[model samples]
Target: MAIALVLVLVVVGSVLFHVLSPWWWTPIASNWSYIDTTLVITFWITGFVFSAVVLFMAYCVYRFRHKEGATAHYEPESRKLESWLTAVTAIGVAAMLAPGLYVWSQFINVPKDATEVEVVAQQWQWSFRLPGKDGKLGTSNVRLVSADNPLGINPDDPNSKDDVVVEAADLHLQIGKPVKMLLRSIDVLHDFYVPEFRAKMDLVPGMVTYFWLTPTRTGTFEVLCAELCGTGHNFMRGTVLVDTEQDYATWLEKQATFAQLSTPAKVGALATPAKDVAKVE
Candidate 1:
C-alpha cells in the first residue's frame, strides 16, 4: 500500500511542481515563438510517456502481487503487446522530431532582403562587422587575424573597406530589420546565443555558420556563449541592443568603419569613441 501510494504521489507531485514552477523561458523578443511552441509540444509528449510508464509499473506491481499458493505466470513476450509498443513508440518519436525539422528549414534559409552581420568570436570575447556605405562586407581570413586586424578583413577586398567594425562592444540592430548573422570563430568552438532572440548557432574554428532573425522589439538582450570553450567560458558575455530606426542610425554613425580605423592618422581620433562604445553593455 505504501509503495503504491508513493508511486501515485510521484505523478501528482511532479505535475504540480511543473505547473507551479517559477522558472520559465524569458519573454521572447524575436519572431521565433515557434521554437517555444515546439518545446512545449516536446515536453507534453515526453511527460505523457514518463507518467504512463511509471503508472504502468505501479499497476503491474499491484495486479501481480503474490498471493497464497499463487505461481508466477511464465508466459514469454506477446506478439500483440510487442506490436502495439513498437507502433506507439514510433509515433511518439515522430511527434517529437517533426516540429524541429520544420523549424530547422526556416533557420537556414535567409531572405535576400535581410542585412548581413558578421560575428567574430574569440576566447571570451565577441566582435561584430556590418556592411558600410557600399552595402557589402569584405572578405576575411583567419590567417590575417592580428591585433591591428582582429577581424581579418581582406584589405584588398574593396567590398570590405567600409565594413563597420564593432570590436569588443555591444551589437545594435534596427527593430524589425531581418538580419542574417554570419558567425565565425578565431580560436575555438563557441556558440552565439541570445535567449530572447530564440536562436543560436555554433562557431567552428575553420568554418562559418549562420542563423537569421528579425528583431521584433526594442530592448537590450544578453549574449551568452552556449558552448563550453575553456576556463573562461563563463566570462564570455556580451549584449545586443535593438533600437529604433533613428537611434540605430545614430549608433551606426558613431561606429568607425574599417577604412577609418585602418588609417594611422585617424587612429588617435578613434580611441575616444572606441572607449565610449566599450563602456556600453
Candidate 2:
C-alpha cells in the first residue's frame, strides 16, 4: 500500500513541478514561434506516457499485492495485448517525429529576397562579410588566406574588391529583412547559435553551411559557439545588432571594403623613398 501511494505521489509531484516551473524558454525574438509549439507538443506526448505508466504501476501494486495465501497465476503472453502495445508505441513515435519533419522543411526553404551574409568562424572568434553596392558576395578559397587576407577572399576576383569585411566585431542586420547566413570555419568545427533567433548551423572546415532568419525586432543579441572546438570553446562569443534600415546602412558605410583594406598597404609599399626623392630633385 505504501509503495502504491509513493508511486502515485511521484506522478502528482512531477505534474505540479512542470506547471509551476519558472525556468522556461526565453521570450522568442524571431519568427520561429512554431518551433516552440512543436516542443510543447513533444512535451505533452511524453508527459502523458510517463504519467500513465507510473499510475498503472501504482494500480498494479495495489490490485496484485501479495495477499495472504494468494496463489500466483502464470500465463503466456497474449497476442491481443501484444498487438495493442505495438500499435500504441507506433502512434507515439509518429506523433513526436511528424512536427520535427515539418519544421525542418520550412527552416531550409529560404526566401528569394533574403540577403546573403558570410559568417567565418575560427578558434575563439567570429567574423562576418557582407555584399557591398553590388549586392553579391565574391568567391573565397582557403588557399588564399594570408596575414593580409584572413577571410581568404580571392584577390583576383573583381567582385571581392568591394565586399565589406568585418573581423572580430559585431554584425549588424536590418530589421524586418530576411538574411541567409553562410557559415564557414577556418580551423576546427564550430556552430553559430543565437538563442533568440532559434537558428544554428555547423561550420565545417572545408565546406560552407547555411541557415536563414528574419530579424523581427531591433536589439542586441549574443552569439555563442554551440560546438566544442578546443580548450577556449567557452570564450568563443560574438554580438549581433539588429537595427533599422537607416542604422544598418550607416553601420555598413563605416566598414572597410576589401579593396580599401588592400589599397593602403599597396600605396605605402610603392611610395618613393626619401633618398630617391632627393636624387630625383
Candidate 3:
C-alpha cells in the first residue's frame, strides 16, 4: 500500500510539473503547428495509458491482498480482453503515426515558388550565398578554399563569379514567402535550429541537407547552433531577420562583396597600358 501510494504521488507530481512548467519551445508560428498538435495528442494518449495501468495495478493489490488462508487465483489471459487491449494499442499507434507521416510529407515537399537559399557552416561562423539574377547557385568545394578564396568559389566557373556571398551577416527573408534552406558544412557536423520556428536540421560536411519554413511573423530570431562542434560552440550564434519585401531588398543591396568588402583587394588590379604609362611620365 505504501509503495503504491508513493508511486502514484511520484507519477502525478511528474505529470503536473510537465504540464505546468514554464519551460517549453516557444509557441508555433509556422506550418509546424500541425506537428505540435499531433505531439499533444500523443502525450494525452500515452499519459492516459500510463495512469490507467498503474492505477489498475494498485487497485488489484489493495482489493486482492493476501489473507490468512486465501490461495492465489491462477487464471490464464482471456482472448477477449487481450484482443481489446491490442486493438486499443493499435488505434493509439495509428493516431500518432498518421499525423506524423502527413507532416513529414508536407515538410519535404516545398512549394513551387519557394526561394532557395544556401547556408554554409564552418567551425564557428556561418556564411550564406544567395542566387543572383540567374536564380541558380553555382557549385562550390572546400578544396578550392585558400587565404584569398574564403568562400571556395570555383574560379573556372563564370556562374559563381556573380554569386552574392554574405559572410558573418544576419540572414534576411521576405515575410510570408516560403524559404527552402540548403545546409552544408565545411568542418564537422552542426545543427541549424530556431526555437520559435520549430525547425531544425543537421549540417553535414560534403553533404547537402535541407529544411523549409515560411515566416509568418516579421521579427528578428536567434539562430542557435544546437550541436556541439568545438570549444567555441556556445558562441556560434547567428541572427535571422524577417522583413517586408522592400526591406529585404534594401538589406541585400547594403551587403558588400568579397572583393569590395575585403580590407585588401584580392582581385588583381588592371594593368596600365605601356602607352598610357609613358604618356603619364
Candidate 4:
C-alpha cells in the first residue's frame, strides 16, 4: 500500500511540478520557437512512459506481495508482450526523432539574404568578425592567430583586409534581419549558446560550424559557452545586442577593419586600433 501510494504521488507530483515550475525557458528572442515545440513533445512522451512504467511496478508490488502459502507461477517469456513492448518503443523513438530531423533540415537551409557573422572562441573569450564594405568575410586559420591578429585572418587574402573585427566585445545585430553565425575555435571545443535564441552550434578546432536566426525583438541577450572548456569555463560570458537598424549601423561604424588593425604605422610597430569592448557597452 505504501509503495502504491508513493508511485501515485510521484506521477501526480511530477506532472504538477512541471506545469507549475517557475524556472522555465527565457522568453524566446529569435526565430527558433520550433525548438521549444520539439522539447515539449519530448517531455510529454517521456513523462507518459515514466508514469505508466511506475504505475505498473506499483501494481506488481501490491498484487504479488507474499501471502500465507501462495505458489509461484513462473513464465519464461511472453512473446505477445515482447512484441507489444517492441512496437511501442519503436513508435516512441520515431516520434522523438522525426521532429529532430525536421528541425535539422530547417536549421541547415539558411536563406540567401542571411548575413554571415563569424564567432571566434578561445579558452574563455569570444570574438566576432563581420564583412566590411566588400560584404565578404576573409579566409582565416588557427596557425595565423597571434597577439596582433587574434582572429588569424590571412593577410594575403585581399578580401580579409576589409573584414571588420570585434574582439572581446558584445555582438550587435540588426533586429528582424536574418544572420548566419559561423563558429570557429582557436583551441578546444566550444558551443555558442543564447537561451533566448534557442539556437546553438559547437566550434571545433580546424573547422567551422554554423546556425542561422533572426532576432524577433530588440533586446540585450546573454551569450554563454555551453561546452565544458578549461578551468575558466564558468567565466566564458558575452553579450548579443539586438538593435534597430540605426543603432546597429552606428555600432558597426565604430569597429576597426583588419587592415586598420594590421597596418603598421612604422617599420615594426603595428597600428594599435582602439578595442571595441569598451565602446560597445
lDDT of 3 by residue, 32-79 (tens): 787787778888888888888888877787778878999988978889
On residues 1-281, what C-alpha lDDT tens digit does candidate 2 reach at each position? 99999999999999999999887877777778878989999999999999999999999999999989999889888999999999999999999999999998988999999999999999889999999899999999989888778899998888888999999999999999999999999989999999999889999999999999899999999999999999999999999999999999999989999998776443344476766645544
Candidate 1 C-alpha lDDT tens digits along 106-157: 9898989999999999998999999999889899999998767888889899
Model 2: residues with Cα > 4 Å off, grouped in runs: 264-281
lDDT of 1: 0.92
Model 4 TM: 0.93
Question: Can you give the TM-score per candidate against the true fold?
Answer: 0.93, 0.91, 0.86, 0.93
lDDT string for model 4 (42-102, tens) is 9999999999998898899889988999998999999999999999999999999999999
Q: How many steric clashes does model 1 contain? A: 1
Task: Give Cα-based local distance difference scores for all models.
Answer: 0.92, 0.92, 0.80, 0.92
Residue pair clashes in candidate 4: none
In candidate 3, what residue range of length 10 has the lowest lDDT sum? 261-270
Spell out the clash pairs found in candidate 2: none
Better of 1 and 2 by TM-score: 1
Give the root-mean-square deviation of each candidate in angstroms: 4.7, 3.6, 4.7, 4.4
Over 4 Å off, model 4 = 266-281
With a 3 Å backbone cut-off (N, CA, C), the pairs that clash in candidate 1 are 138-160
